[model samples]
Target: MAADDIAGLIREAIPDAVVEITDLAGDGDHYAAKVISESFRGLSRVRQHQAVYAALGGRMGGVLHALQLTTAVPT
Candidate 1:
């Protein structure tokens, strides 16, 4: 999948999110994403990852695989 597509999906789930995607393997499948949003402020790391996975709408294990996600609230 494209980086823009990943960012778009995240943005759709978290409207106020700031997403940055990096193709770790340059193979379109492996990626590292940084998502910053107020929604993650009080949530745990697991919860934050869950939120992002939910945003992907089941694409995590399907079309998209091997994602390294980092989430944080804007300072």
Candidate 2:
């Protein structure tokens, strides 16, 4: 999938989230993303990543290969 398409998926999953997605290279399999949302407030880093993965509905396993994720609660 395209970078923006992947970004959109994340946004859809967390409606209140602010998502920034970037393809690390030309390869769609690798990506870097920064997401900020109130939903992440009390969640640990691992949990935050898990939430995003859950939003992808298992796509992370196949369609999406690698993701470097950063999650934060809004100030």
Q: Evaluate model 2: give its lDDT.
A: 0.88
Deviation from native of the Cα of residue 4 in model 1, angstroms: 0.6
Winning candidate number (lDDT): 1
User: For residues 1-75, what per-residue lDDT tens digits would candidate 1 score against the true structure?
Assistant: 899999999999999999999999999999999999999999999999999999999998778988999999999
Error of 2 at 27 (Å): 1.5
Q: Each candidate: what lDDT?
A: 0.95, 0.88
lDDT of 1: 0.95
Estimated TM-score per prediction? 0.96, 0.91
Question: Which candidate gets the maximum TM-score versus the true structure?
Answer: 1
Name the lDDT value of residue 52 in candidate 2. 89
